[model samples]
Target chain A: MKNLKYLISLIIGHLTVFKHIFKKPVTLEYPEKKIELNDKFRGEHAFDVEKCTACGTCQRVCPSFGTIEIEKEKDENGKFYPKNYSIDLNKCIFCGNCVQYCPFGAIKMTQNYELADEKKSTLKLEINTLKRNYFDNIIDK
Target chain B: MDYLYFLYLELLHKWNLPDYIAMVTFPIIPFCFVAAALIVVVIFLVLAERKILAFFTQRKGPNRVGPWGLFQTIADAIKLLCKENITPEGTDKFLFTLAPLLAFIPVLVVWGIIPFCNEFDIISFSINSLLFVVIAAIPILGILLAGYASNNKYSLIGSVRSVAQAISYELPLIFVLLSIVVLASSMNLKQIVLAQSSIYPFCGYFVFPAFLGFVVFFACGIAELNRCPFDLPEAESELVSGYNTEYSGMKFAFFFLAEYAMMFIMCAFIATLFLGGFLSPLGFYVGEKLIPNEFLANLSVYFEQAFWVFVKTFFLIFCMIWVRATLPRLKSHQLTAFAWKVLLPLSLLNLLIVCLIKAVL
Candidate 1:
């Protein structure tokens, strides 16, 4: 039976060789075919200010010390609202807890998956840039 | 290098009797060429695989080398080649030297019987040449040799795992091969390719109807190659380079090249058998339209032949890479159990089906 096994393997060895000759290769020539990432992809974090209620939920929930800060101001209706809030992108783990606990749906996850930066300050992100500049663009629109 | 080539060429001529005789003696010529091709394919496979994984995992793989990092492999290869070769002092020097060669020989040897041409016009290999199965055993032996010779406890452990996995996986692979042999009714790879040239009605190229064997064959092949999920022998984070732990320099490079080479050969083999070697996907027309002239069409068929082989190999390599990116390496015991418990029974069943179909048809 053992010798029989050797003969059998010898006789049939080419099946693997022949079967592989003419199928569409699984290689996707990239740059030509850019893979699309999903919107809520848990990549590195991007922050939005218009979405941020400035309730400091992001800063408060953050376990990492000195990672986040929120500055408050009076809105047009005299209601206290977030004027300036900054989360150290380096410190922020993208825990999404800030996004989750936001009572106002102001904080959002962006599709910008890439977050590599050379400068140290680049890591210390200000969420205002990611905000929808609705008032700034209202007249332009 | 030129002097060396000259030396090899002189040696080849000295040994040459007829083209057929020369073919057997001069396996190194074709072997070298094939090995080179596999290395290139492996690089391409690595890049494509990383990119695919990045896509699935929601990230971009290396995109900085050339536009979208097409030349990333060249850079990486240069990097590895240039890096320091660190040989551990507390190792068996001779066995350490031999280990990578042991790990690599199987990949080269397996290429011996791949039927690349239909009419068998160009090559001087015999009318009845089938050496691939024999070559397949070389790497298994090589891995075992590497593990023992490395003289590391982890290396010892990995070598044992490799032995166990190779023994268990060998059964299903052979069974799957048996199914194909039954279909073609010939052990010769060229004969098998000739068998596939004429399209059949139901059992088309042993993929459909006999697809169960194809699946099992592919799975076993993956385990045999010691790739992801089955990468117990070289489970990097755990075993610390596994069987070749003490290797360094060109020695390490040889092992690296051989690992990729095995991947390329196994992938190509799987693609050729189940997918249809060098035959146009629809069995015609791609070649016809590419060159309206009949003579050109004949030329295009050769391209089509090479093209299909390339494509199939690339796809299988991609799948291997995909599994690598997605799944963690399998535990040694789990790897054995999967080969025995899941793959073995399924392949046996697949063999039974193929036999029944062959008997009926």
Candidate 2:
């Protein structure tokens, strides 16, 4: 009978729920356990000092003004190295254009994406921190 | 000496209290116990429902609090208590303030007649079955008042839907309960439980012959409580938070508590009516065999009876939660039609069958 099937189906539905009680939950508890990001994830920028030409290509390609600042100051050999290189993460959209357009791959996106900070000034990445991060993450690892 | 009688005398003697004062104080004691126990049970029931629902949906619910989110409801309760009690602008201030209390107080009041065990019974009124029905219906009036007093259109529509759903479901519920009344030959809840103890053709729980009615009663009860699968009144997509739309902070908490408490009360009522109340499901013979020590055995019986009552009640509550997790909310028309067309006729037939069996026997 149709009613009998309905009753059996109801029992089956309940059994399904009962079965799920034993199954492992799929939720990854935030902060304690973060999901692994893919290779393509456009995250924090890392600057390779040895490879960077200080050609100001990154600053020019950046769509958002005031995000990437590159200053050229001549070294003792009269070759230009960046005098003041800064990336304001507050303005950087993480579009990866800076990483993509770099001919020498001087700038790269890192796997570290936990970028939240209490202060606005802290979010801005300086040349020293960027170079340190690049050497520490890319060259050493 | 009867221990109850011994305690009665010793209490009066120790306190130097008069007989009238002792008698007056005796009833208030169980009332306080029931009130305390109900709140504690509601707190756990809310947590259990959320956890079970999460499990059914295959997600971890509320695991951020104390281990496995055990204290999540406590944190929620504290937050509700601390939040600003907001009364929206241009509302009927007096009735709006009164509505949540109206919704809440009746649920605690209904526990006045519900017997946990023979010794723990507060009221033990002869017509407690009828008393429960009357008291349970009173919350709807509060819900309606809440909707009207809020001066909100969504709330008014929700109140109307709630009333419609409640009235339709109430018919089949009362009818099913009436069938049980016919079988038990008394309206007292304690008497109904007692009547189920006699094993005539089999263990004389009316659930066997009145299976149809039991099903009807449960479905109607879900509708009456405005729970999921029958929760059209507060349908999230249709009406924003329903009758309690304008309520906030502790007032909203009252409505929330009352709903969960009512769920507990209904589950306990089902246990009493159809699942043999505080009596062991395996019966006394099994209990005796399981425990041979006379002193411990005697002590265990009282505790065991109360424990079984809680077990049966919680099992029924879990089933209700399971249903909530499994089923989708019914359309408003389907909800009404199912009550009138399917459950109403089935309950009527069930009542007729019960009366015929009662008369023949």
Candidate 3:
């Protein structure tokens, strides 16, 4: 039995290497090929002024304190709406918690993953400036 | 004395250079080239082995430096170089300094004998076959140098252990080598390779009658290299650096470089010994006969031979890495005793079987 095991091992040893001969060699060569970050990539967050009801739902949903900020404006009708909905995109975890509870798809994730900026403040997401490419791509195709 | 003569002939006589320059600079070039090449090969082998193992393990290996971590070795070299050339003051400074080089140079010289491609041939053959064995015998000296030179307690123990381990494995490895020489009846490696050509067609490799010999040789060769499972000397968690506890800087790197160079050579040696030494496995009889162009046929023949040889060697290397990552290192006595009680006996049986087969055939 030991001899059989040894013989089996000896024969199987060379054969096992063949398993990797055609394997999907897990190497990405990353710099050469950018990662195919999925649409559900859960990346930097964007603000949607047209849709955000300004219920302060997102601010409450944000686990990281000071990640989202809401400004208020009162109309003559005595109704309050968000004057500005801003997110420190740097602090946003892209947890999609805000997305789940968002009654209106006001704040959501964007596809822009390379968010690196020279200035720290460059990462700030102003509702007015937030590009809707994430939503646009979702709808366009 | 001999090397100094090689220095003069190569530098002064051949190049018509000044004796001072020849003596000072010329000898250094081969050494430096060898040293540099060995270092580079070791780094490449380590990266490659890691990457290949990662492939098997389903993960990305060091992929940060210079795209796929090509510069990772450079970073390592820099770090190792800058760290420290610390020698325990009580150590035999000269031998401690020399140990890694001694452990290293044999592996490098083995490459001097191995032919990589048809064009990569580097060995110079001579009358006495003893020279090949004599040069091949240098690694033991290096192992001894490493063991005895370092004055540390563990280094002394590890060196002695390694010497025993190395010498025990050496017997089987040599027997396998001799088995090949018996078949080809030539000590010259080039002749051994030439004999593997498609003259007999199906029998290009010496693996048929010598199959057991080749297998035993490869197994013993791995043990001789002192890799994992067989890595008794530097079995970390026991002996910190084994024989290399006291070595550092370029000396340590030389040892490191030598280890990988030997691994590469061992693969090449296995290829040369069994897989038809640069003879196209497919080119056996048919292609050689049908192809009108001799050069084209021979070129294809060599290319085919080189491919199989490379495949076999790399596969073995991958196996070594797998064993390294999978198994535990053997104890010192178990390491030597296994060689004596198991591999030694098996190799002798293999030798007898091979002889009987030859006699009957």
Candidate 4:
């Protein structure tokens, strides 16, 4: 009777495993498929050159200094325009302060968070690269 | 035997090959075939085990290497081959070097008597059952040599555990095998399989009458192979890979290969003795009707037989993997006690029952 009990337990244990052989695996192949992130996910920053008034509010709100840089320069029309704007991604902590504090809505966080780079210098995104990366990830359709 | 001799002569006549050359090369060819089959099967078995374990644990394993990780073992093989062969200081260099070969070669030798398909039998003997028991015992010597030569305390402990495990388990295994031998009334593995053909309705396998013996044999076989639940010999959490702790590169690869190859051999042995060998579970008539080729039917019939053997072996292996995933390792004392207290008496009783039945019928 004890032997029969053990044999039944063994079969039950095996049945539990055999059932799993048919179920779809829970592993999402990361490179081919990305998990959907929530709307409030603070990721890489995007800069809009046309909307920025260059009030430097984003720089002031940033807890980590040297992360957001706004340089002022007079354009051909003689108006003070932001020039050579840069975000040092190494120090940026994906905090929404820059997005929250920006007066003209110039800096907003995009959902593109694959921010790894081989060189530290490459992670320091210039305004153009930031604009491209942010817009590229947006599904227009 | 005479037909096999004539087969060689016929082959030489067809190819116009010299008699002396044929005589010299005839014996070595079987080993070559076994070795090739062993390497190929081990590679696939490793991949299959990883994939099956992954499924059981709700994870994906080795899918990046090839299509569903089919090439993962190949990549691992390449990596192991390229790694530096390191011999630690204060180790017995000669014995350490020889240990993996010692571990590997005997497992290969057991394949000689395994009748894969009907026509693919390499060398069959009347005492094939005894041959299996004897060859299976030889790997412990290699394990002991590996442990002692490594000069590591952990390896030594692991090897000692292995020796103890092997000794304890062999008794139950022998009893189980002896019962089967008595039930079939033959010591020949092929004849034993043949006796099973008409016993049951669908499969006619001995697993029906000798189910207790099958259970004991399988449990002992798992212990003999140093697998999970009985894997105290190579318990990674406790002994750091057990007896093969100091081995690396191709030496470690050899040990790994030998372990999986032994799993295949044991499963095949079980399939042969109790599960109807290479006979289709649906019986020969169904398999023959499916082929329906009067001219090329013989070849197709052998193919079907080989196919059934493959299916049964893999099914048994999958069960083995499932048990590995579900169970935890047994403590050394518990492992030995299970063998001596639980399994020994059970197997002894099974043997007596089988002998009495044999006497009556």
Q: Which has the greatest DockQ?
A: 2
For each candidate, what is the lDDT?
A: 0.68, 0.86, 0.71, 0.86
Please write out the lDDT profile of model 4 over residues B1-361, one tens digit for every residue: 3445668878998999978887788778767988998999999999999988999988898888878778999999999999999999999999999889989999998887777777666668788888999998888999999999999999999999999999999999999899888878788887887778784454567787778899899999999999998988888988899999998999999999999999999999988888988887775545467657774576577677777877888988987898999887887788988999999998998888887777887
Candidate 2 chain B lowest-lDDT run of ten: B1-10
Segments in model 1 whose C-alpha atoms lie over 4 Å from true places: A1-141, B1-32, B119-130, B199-203, B288-295
DockQ of each: 0.04, 0.66, 0.20, 0.54
TM-score of 1: 0.65
> Residue A21's C-alpha lDDT in candidate 3?
49
RMSD of each: 10.4, 3.5, 6.9, 3.6
Stretch of 10 with least lDDT, candidate 1 chain B: B120-129
Q: How do the residues B1-361 of candidate 1 rate in per-residue lDDT, one tens digit apiece?
A: 2333455567767876444554454545656666676677778866877776565554666878998889998787887788786657666667767767777766655664565544322222433223555567677777777777766888888777887888888888888777777787876666665567655432367687568888788778888878877888888888897887866667777777787777777877776667776555666648777777997786667667777777777887766665565456777677878788878888889888988887888
Candidate 2 residue lDDT tens string, B2-35: 3555587687989787788766676677678888
Better of 2 and 3 by TM-score: 2
Q: What is the per-residue lDDT of model 2 for residues A1-141, given as tens digits with 9 covering 90 to 100?
A: 998898899899889878998899988888889898888888888898777779988888999998998887888987878888899999999899989889889998887888999999989999998988898777776
TM-score of 3: 0.68
Misplaced by over 4 Å in model 2 are A1-15, A54-88, A95-103, A118-122, B1-6, B14-16, B83-90, B198-204, B285-296, B353-361
- Model 4 Cα lDDT, one tens digit per residue, A64-141: 989988888877887777887899989998889988887777777778778888999999989898777556654341
What would the TM-scores of all predictions be?
0.65, 0.87, 0.68, 0.86
Candidate 3, residues B1-361: lDDT per residue as tens digits?
A: 2433564567566767766775566445545655576666678888988777676666777888888689888888888888777877667778776667676666666666665455444554642233445665677677677777676778877777777877888887777777777767788776777776765664767887777777777667778777887887777888897887777887887777777778876777777778766665565535457789986775565456556666767777876787665556777677778778877677777777767766785
CAPRI verdict on model 4?
medium
* iRMS (Å) per candidate: 10.6, 0.8, 3.6, 1.1
The number of the candidate with the highest lDDT is 2
